[model samples]
Target: MNATVLKFGGSSFRHTEDYHRVAGHIADRLATGEGKIVAVVSAMSGITDNLKEVMLNVNKKASPSNVDAALATGEMISACCLEAAISRLRIPVMSLNGYSLGIRTNSDFGRASIESVDPKQIMAALLEHDVIVAAGAQAIDQSGRLTFLGRNSSDLTAIVIASMLGEHACEIYSDVPGVYTADPYLVPGAQLIPELAYQTILQMSLHGAKVLHHRGVHYAEKHRVSIICKSLTSDGAITGTIVSGHGNARSVTVARDSPVFSCASLEECDSLCALLARHDINVLRLEDSHGVRVCIVSDIDFAQRLVSLADIGPVFIGLSNVVTELDSSGLLVHLVGDYDGAISLVRQIHEQMYPAVVSVPFGASV
Candidate 1:
């Protein structure tokens, strides 16, 4: 059962035509003697956010289970669309969603953790079809209810699928060619990294690099799976960086605006922090002139819900990014006033870190 696992991020499918483009790529791979192909796809660009917005706008108090069900539709639609495109090419293809994917998770709806994976279904599907499109970042709980993995979590789904299916490596395609010293889109001086250690990328993700999900990297390390990051272009697929057991480098990461909750006292802050931690939410504690504050860096919506459930009134701070320099020494975090400032700091940090390489521009040649 030799199969090639590939994941196409939301950026890959910005419109309906993009699906056809990707389908063509898959067909070409199959035609080129690539055996079984398993493609994990995310929702079309901004589709997930659009769906989430509509769901929450109508029912602000929607249960986690219900929200998961609504949010998973984006990827489901993507899977089906891709399947249709592949079918149009007269290729034997099929699409599977959370229900049929055979990956089971706990009842932690918003950020469900995988409990087990039964690859028989996927294997059987692959045996019948040339390409199998699996909806990313979704699974079913013990009760068979739909559960979303998390925001920007399609990477995790792809890695898990590759590992469970006995595949040693998985290729992830996104807007960028590969991991860079900083986000290439924002930092023009950012240079593409050819390779990286699992631990290094994991730390980058943990501190706020968007190249890969931290949880996914953790799972890949445990399963000894190598992640090949690439970008799909009109010319074809271009390999960028490979994440495995070796390589080292310094990078800068800028996190999105995190929800900050002001706690009255230190005890209250610690208690709230522990509760969030138990739920697997990441938080950072801070002491300021006002009092104690807990910054929710993981999933802001889920964190807000938990805070409300705990009967705590969260003080909403304006959007801000926490920029950090990642290296062997330690993390040097800087609190940026805004996203612009964060990008500026990232450029400064990246320039200072790799001054000689700042002139290089990333492209297919890399």
Candidate 2:
């Protein structure tokens, strides 16, 4: 009836030593009188990609079902490895795949949608095992074939389990300490968002913030399950970022690493927008430069789609080799929360917290 879920991404288990370190974290948590904790783990880093390559080499014409099975081996392997590592720490731990934990999905193979989870079985397992290590991403269909839940589904996996048990929050441990205003690498002065609204993070995630999956955040928002994003590669007691429904409503900016398609006219823009929308690809932003219009190609799928639309190359600023001429100079600024009033003009922008922090060197700590 009560539990805490810990979700670890592939980056956390990059090596055998990493597994040992993760186990140490788990063991320490259990020691702190945390009754029952469930760990939803992803495949080790590079393991999933390597497994997909194996499938490609062995069978060029492999079925979607086979690909699903191959892709799942990474998480399955991770769960087992963690189980072993934790057991060595003198803790009782058990590894369970999505199916074993009652995670059911639709028959979508590489892009499965979780339909339901058997809470009875999950509860029974928690009663018997000190730690339940559930494999993330991959689940079984109605016909019982292993299927993956798209990219970053491990976070979804943990959220689902936590929601099933009515837990308020799930702790997602990753390499990054917490979500930031922008990619720290790009904006070196970017500040860590101490707390954020779920909707804010969801938009950030959708607009190419690699902190967590949008679907995962959607599930959390719908189920009222908050998420805490922290770093596994950090020192003691890092609280990280708490993503919930309550936060200051302000325009949050996030940048993405992608290109844009500049349309010459409003007619060209309308057609291009409609086409990409039909394919379910989101255009991050649109800029009107005098008589010309530009559509930022933030979504990777949209970029791929441009390759076959060479016939309409001229429509997009007379560029036939559209994909070849990727404009990496542009970055996306995703806005979160709501704001009223129409903008008179669009000029310059600023990173998260401002260019206004005056420190009084001679004053007392304030």
Clashes of 1: 0
Ten contiguous residues minimizing lDDT sum, candidate 1: 357-366
Task: Determine which window of 10 residues in candidate 2 has minimal summed lDDT.
Answer: 338-347
Question: Which pairs of residues clash in candidate 2, taking residues 3 or more apart in a chain or in different chains?
Answer: none
How well is each residue in 28-53 modelled by candidate 2, as lDDT tens digits?
88888888889999998888778888
Candidate maximizing lDDT: 1
**lDDT values, one for every candidate:** 0.88, 0.70
Candidate 1 regions with alpha-carbon error over 4 angstroms: 311-314, 360-366
Candidate 2 segments whose C-alpha is farther than 4 A from its true place: 248-353, 357-366
